[model samples]
Target: MQQTTVAKTVTYTGIGLHSGKSVTITLHPAPINSGIIFARTDLPGIPQVAAVAGNVTNAMRATTLESGVAKVFTVEHLLAAFYAMGIDNCLIEINSVEPPVADGSSLPFVRLLEEAGSVEQEALRNIIDVKEAQTIRVNDSFITIVPYDGFRITFTSINPHPMLGVQFGDYEINTETFVKEIASARTIGFMHEVKLLQDQGLALGGSLENVVVYDDETVLTPLRFSDELVRHKILDVVGDLALVGRIKGHVIAVKSSHAINTALAKKIIESCSK
Candidate 1:
């Protein structure tokens, strides 16, 4: 397959998820093999940060990439859009540390990229083909990848809440499947944890419209899918793994978080070098 990039520039403006501040992002077409790069236009000199596992500085509540003094937060949503859309290279210019949390799902970014369109490049795609089984474990959560002809994911999310117990999803991911099955899954949070997160300066812009919030007894918002939570987990896996470029494998994840997902990404990067 050939590398691809947006055919034209597109811009979107909204409120940052963590910063709770207004920001604008402009997506520009990039040359072949340039990969996805993020530029912090608000910072001096407009420093750029590459979307790679090695540059990840934080994965607490979200993925954060850093290079030198420049940092970009909560990048997984946009990155997942690029991956599922088959976009190989892009230059993202943002005016804040975090991208807008549009409906707390990748669907908005998907539509934005669709508006920009896509054009094939002269070079071929750089695909990471998983040759052998690789697994990473963190506590009870684990992620495993095995050789496969195409990108696929089998995810299981386990929550003790009465409203959410165990959810499972299996999908062969592509543009069509992603748009239909995964892109609309919104991020989730619990009412009990809201104050704690806010005290730590997180989820400042989250709302019922942007996040699927659950209380002790029931979910505050209507679910898009019966298993929307797990579907969103799969969405996050796709986004976090985007750091390693295109992948051809079957991934199985259980209660995986950003840290665990990015650890698998780092593991993939390390194996490629050997």
Candidate 2:
């Protein structure tokens, strides 16, 4: 497959999950082989940061990327949207340090990208195929990548809360399926965890409108799907895997989070580069 970029610029504006600030983000087409880069438009000259696993500086509330003096937080959802749309080369220009939460799902971003339109690039795309099985685990959580012909993912999430108990989903990912099945699964949180996150000075802009908050027995808003928690995990895997610079292979994830996701991506890159 060939590399891809948008045909025209697109802009999105909303509230950030952290910092609670109003933000505007613009996506511009990048040249072939440019990869995915983030530009800080609010700064003096729009400093750019490459979206690589090594740039991940924090994984507490959400994944964050940092450069010398520029940093961006909670970018996974947007990245997932781009990955789902098969856009490999783009310059994401943002007027804030954090991207807009946009209903806590990638759907809005997906919509924005669709309106931007896409074009094929001249360069052939790269794929990191797993020739051997590799796994990473932390406690009961683990994720693995094994050899496969194309992109596929199976994921599970286990939370004791009745609304978000053990759940599973499996899908062969493509541009259509990613947008239809995964993009709208909002980032979920437990009511109990909300206080902790707030205490940590995170989720500053999170609310019923932007996140799926689960109490002991029910989600605060209408349930998107019974297995949305797992689906969101799948969404996160797509976003996290985008750090590898290309989409390839199958991934099986069990209770994996940002930390394990990044670790696995790095491992795959290191292994394939050998």
Which pairs clash (backbone N, Cα, C closer than 3 Å) in model 2? none
lDDT of 1 at 118: 99
List where candidate 2 sits over 4 angstroms from the true fold: none
Q: Pick the candidate with the highest TM-score.
A: 1
Structural similarity to truth (TM-score) of each candidate: 0.99, 0.97
> Number of backbone collisions per candidate, in order?
0, 0
Over the stretch 127-164, how does candidate 1's per-residue lDDT look in tens digits? 99999988999889999999999999999999999988
List where candidate 1 sits over 4 angstroms from the true fold: none
The lDDT of each candidate is 0.95, 0.88
Candidate 1 Cα lDDT to native: 0.95
Question: Candidate 2 residues 93-175, lDDT tens each?
Answer: 89899999999999999999899999998989887777898899999999999889988999888877866668989999898
